[model samples]
Target: MTHTPVDQADPPTPHRDLHSEQGALRGEHPGRAENPVIKVADLAWLEFEKPDLDRAETFARDFGFAIAARTEEALWLRGTFAGPPCMVIRRGRASRFIGPAFRAAERTDLVRLAAATGHAVRDIDVPGGAKSVSLLDPSGLPVRVVHCGEQLPALPEQEPLLLNFGTDHRRTNTTQRPPREPSRIQRLGHVVLETRSFLRTLDWYLDTLGLIVSDFLFLDGQRRRGPTMAFIRCDQGSLPVDHHTLALHLGPGTGYVHSAYQVTDLDSIAAGGEYLAERGYQRSWGIGRHIQGSQLFDYWRDPDRFMLEHFADGDLFSCDLEPGWAPMSASGLAQWGPPVTRDFLGANPSPAKLREVITALRDDNELDPARLLGLMKAMSS
Candidate 1:
């Protein structure tokens, strides 16, 4: 896979002193060992739209993200978190791409992660009070890390179909207070990937990035779902984190696996799902429970078709643990759902269809036609 080398932007001004020093995690600087007040806080992903920047921006706002800022090249979206930007939409003639970002407890940890992983880490200076380290994952999507932000915002329930007093006022259970919304991201959780070299990628993340395997799926020659799938956690805890922050599958080019966002509880998962549906967004998967992370899961497809998941009540660890190697099989992927569906993996968009759409957008002068068209056409053609 080839890409135009990004113009080497100036590195962000280092802020080694400002980070909260608490029970700083393992990879942090030796001097910052006592910094315990760390939060796994926030995550950022990509959404690429071919023809309309306005449409993409509108969808993001309607979906509960706050529009932090925009430029000719991209639009930065923020959730309730106090971080710079949790999501970004780069003007392009393509769909969504999930790029996962891992947080560093301190600047020293960033140094360690960059050195050990061989990922070129650069600081990103955003306008006003935003700062971050922008880098690329193995899959080539932009990923970044910055300070944590506020919690997810509270959205009102969609108006019921009938707004009259005569509407069905069924028996009310007044004892229960309305459920609380999901908490702000403590830090970015994990990202799953589908790659041709699953083992190699998995090993790279573990060896270079300091991620520990909580569990794994041992597969046979045919790639049929086996008995167990592997689970890995960051090597900084005793209680296993929502298992497997990053996962990979044997398949095609480095495309997204799935980006998992954390919420506070099961009620928030259900409430948020309902809230999204009422707001007229498309719900892709879930509203079901999962076997591995042990959370209530709900998935929605954003405008660019990236699968964004809302998970609540997940398993956590006391400390970073080792990998749990298990048999890889079909049945083990889910604890409960209708069945594993192909659409979830994004088998819908074929190469030809994507090319056609890109072509149409370029010809119509939609989006960043001049700058992005060349890249889109090359990939598509």
Candidate 2:
């Protein structure tokens, strides 16, 4: 038998038509406004109301937050980075997320915002002295834009672990061991929320706070209907900022989903996960890289069942890049990780959730039967 000559040419490579930021903007919303009221500098802090302050303080410490100030009525939690506290938990009869506060780039921005919105600028009664203009979003969530005259000084930084790589060993003879402690949080990265009026809420952020969308996700068969999810970032001109400072998705209910805080690296995420696990805290979903921001993330639940995340190595983008669009599905959440948890997806049925679904369907809002069915399908997918 004559032996056939071995094929010398390489196999044909599959072509992937990757989506470009500019190309994705075709016939879609520009994810920005022509003239915004005021461009926010960054997220200042989140506010919450909890019945138990001591318990909240304990979890805050375990979640790697430094107590900036604590009183009988409130607790202010800060990260290692300088700025305002990451969050404030106030004493209340019920436990719930109040809302998010954004930092104004200039004090005059607050005056402009107040004039445009007809809300008066008032002094914020927090540890840091600041003036704020408050307004309610379309979904009835409280939103504040604040300008602080003084910021908390930067804390001592937590150095990243030295590692050894193949042919580029940086450490010799040194044992690799990250301590089993809470991951030191650097700063608040982003907050995710679910709203029934997604389009209106998204537009409000873009027009009011001058936020720009970094990415948009629509249901599998509903691209014409518009995006159901958006990852928004601050418009810092040419300065690169976190890929998403705020993310919103359409759902039956309107409320907080989760918030992420940046840590040092992967070792911080893993070792810190171990620390939380040993303390009997519940891990919701994590040890994976996200597709949108490309952050290595780990999520956990606090005593009040509020979700918080420890994330690192997130992508940064400037204002020049337009928003990229993609189809939303369970599998699209992360580039590589374990299956998304049912808890994180809110798949577990509860009485409150059932009531919210019924009310959203009956009322006049963006969510309808078709959109609800699409959301269900996306979750299952």
Best of the candidates, TM-score: 2
Q: State candidate 1's TM-score.
A: 0.62
**TM-score against truth, every candidate:** 0.62, 0.94
Tens-digit lDDT track of model 1 for 1-381: 111113222223242111121312232112111222232322334334445678777665544455667888778766543444556667776665646655555556555555544665564534343234555544345555443333334333322122224666653554434333332332235566655344444444544445554444433321122211235555455444555566665443455756666655555566666666776778777777766566677777766666777775676753433333333443445577755555664545799646744654544221234323332232232
For model 1, the local distance difference test gives: 0.49
Candidate-wise lDDT, in order = 0.49, 0.88
Error of 2 at 84 (Å): 0.9
RMSD of 1: 14.6
